[model samples]
Target: MKKLTIAFLIITLFMPKQSNAQSNGAAGAIAVGAGLLAIGAGIAAMEDMKERAELTATQWVLANHPELNSFSLKTLDFNGKKTKDMSSTSVISFKIQEFSPTDNPTLDGKKQILLAFTSYGWISDQGIDFNKVNWYLIDSTEWLNMMVAYAKVASKEKNETVLKDVLNNGLVVNKGIKAKGKTEIPFFKLEGDMYLVTDYSSEMKLVYNEKTLGIFLKDTGNLVQMARAAVIDTHEFFFLTK
Candidate 1:
């Protein structure tokens, strides 16, 4: 019973917005809990949580969001193990389908189902903290366009300018940010010495003064070979400011 209480406390404290995995939130607690529990049960706990999360998320979505019934379900990389490395936060994303036939397509007609958890452990969406759990939509077409622009720059077929347009436009189209036809690269401003980690498999990590802020961007390998370069260029940028 005490262990269960501890787990609940862990879950409450770790609930993060968009699974940012701050120095004080989700990543730290889950990493410690997983490490201690693994000594006795091996590394299955995290994987089990992921599986349960998928089941619960699927059910919850179908029940609450009938509009997505026809779309396919796909579980995205949640960065559960990478949380231990502090390279990324744990976020579960499900891509709904090939295209959006709805009267209002999210982005060129595509939908994304996203759910965030405080830990890798499976907790029913009902039992989980509502503040952390989120079901949102992303413009898949715009995101793909950004990736294609990056590929162009990588292959030397186009300059960074094209990529920049796609990324900034994505923000306006998907997020509805009031940019007023301007380029706004999402970046974090931190104080003190900064540490930049570039892990191709993991999301981009922004560490400041030895504490991890969170994963700034996903699939950063496509942005640029080095994370710093991605932030420095016009077509692509992470925008880490001091």
Candidate 2:
């Protein structure tokens, strides 16, 4: 984790777009996030390192998400054909709140557990492949972080006023913003210090920074940014900003 922290600090220090000004104006924030993704892609070039990083990341998710102290992950081939030496597309869907393929039916008709690694598209043909191969776990809600991601975006887009007026500062779970049945889940909360913690009921912590929308897995007091999940402009009712 020290290694990743050093990497993060280096990135934060060197990131050129640390300003709020952009030709695109307020829209620049999205551009800034995009820039960060490009920076992450440029940070490495090793299969072994990528594997270890992904595994560590998976462990973090297991520990923090859905109160799972023990879980297993397996490498999947993705069974796709268009593999043309690091394509820009990912076989695994990076869709916000992505669900399992409906066609992949199960005997009991329950939704299959899926914790897909979505960092490959960011890595490109020459970078640290955090998830070199596609992956999915069995019977997992670990991906609910994606839903938390939607709340993050909505907090900025549709509900920006709610955040600034009500939650500009508050304790974590102790001070949560209530949701309607449309977006209510008893487990979600805006943890103090701005980490949007989802699994508040567990010893492990699954948090997403409202500032960066970077989802992390926390265990034993260490935080690791395993993935960046964002919903740019599409809200249930709001339109995209120009």
Candidate 3:
């Protein structure tokens, strides 16, 4: 009788121990699955945030201005050097002569203006060498056209703050200000020490101070006078200025 009682007690303890082991294993499996799901949710949230940021930036730019159509990015040599060709990431190329309000209007209008720009080359052992020609023509013609259009709108509203912001931000002045008049017209001395007129009409010849920036006006007439200036102080131009 004693032996049977001892055997029964041992059996009861052993059964419960096995059952508890199985329960713990099941709980661990569920916990691991929950952890993986949490990780996946976090990753999705990050991607969503990135997309929202990009969309917000785009909307802000479009809502503020109009009269710009089809911005693009292209690689070109601006410095007249025959270095290795490189790609520009966000070079904003707009259609000046082609842009019309009918086909593409501002965000305020029915149509939403597409604003795009390119980024330049990456930093590496070989530094960034974007062809200067690419920037020159666009800066002179297309970029200027957009600025002129924006200026017209700003001037119509008589918004000096907006007008100044547009000129200072849109117009790429490579040099610091050489001379500024109190009458709201700002003159810049380029990196090459060439003087440029920023607030003139588009029909005037684009002229610069030869001594500093060394920009030579090919044509001297009414049309060229109105051409806007993109004065930059490059690495080479800075040395020349000193």
Candidate 4:
């Protein structure tokens, strides 16, 4: 986490020495310093949030599914997909380094499992949106195909509508569709237990198979505990079953 220091700001302000130079140089320095501070603060906040989320995920695994602890955890960057706007997600990818006795046959055979979480201030005052936290079993072939598809569109410098059209109808996985035995979304083939976002208050919870699993609050005090438990439980319910 990067922080802006008062000493740095003061030094920047004093770096301008002459009469005319003092006014313009000091103003420019102040602007640059302020920009740097804002960038630093933003980066620090993002890092803090990711750490908190990861901690919460760890707690969930430890408390409920000690068996899953065998799988190594890797935290990825904040942006799941690059966009021109403020939209982004924090990602955590779990990989099974080796075969384990407790591993789910379905999950253990795969390369990696991904968990993507995000919070949008415009959507709700609540911290992380449970529904927005997505889990997926990574299929390297499908992923690569999607990436190549996207790259083709990107290379063409297509307009936004064209790009969206490609995403909506370009890449089709007949095998995924047949295996899923359902209609597929443009870029995604939905699988596993589905969940809906029902609460946005100070506390967050998810109800699945008639079981409620959370009293998670929307703050950093118990962030690790909240996130870890929620993630592990959710994965067990959704991803593990798949």
For model 4, what is the C-alpha lDDT against the true structure?
Answer: 0.40
lDDT of 2 by residue, 1-242 (tens): 64467557665654456464554454655555765676566454343544654465565455556644333333222212122223233322211122334575332322223334343344555644544433434321333334433344434333444443322222112113333312232223454356555543333344555323332323223333332221221111011111
TM-score of each: 0.35, 0.25, 0.22, 0.38
lDDT per residue as tens, model 3, 110-205: 221122222344223453332311222333333335444433332242455555444543332323222242224333323543344434344222
- Which lDDT tens digits does candidate 4 get at residues 49-71? 66766665556556655645455
Q: How close is candidate 1 to the true structure, as a TM-score?
A: 0.35
Q: Could you tell me the TM-score of candidate 4? A: 0.38
Candidate 3, residue 124: the lDDT equals 30
* Cα error of candidate 1 at position 176, Å: 25
Q: Between 2 and 4, whose TM-score is larger?
A: 4
Candidate ordering by lDDT (highest first): 1, 4, 2, 3
- Give the distance in Å from residue 79's predicted Cα in candidate 3 to where it truly belongs: 34
Ranking by TM-score: 4, 1, 2, 3
Minimum summed lDDT over a 10-residue window in model 2 is located at: 233-242
On lDDT, the leading prediction is: 1
Report the number of clashing residue pairs per model.
3, 3, 33, 7
Off by over 4 Å in 1: 1-40, 80-89, 98-131, 142-161, 164-242
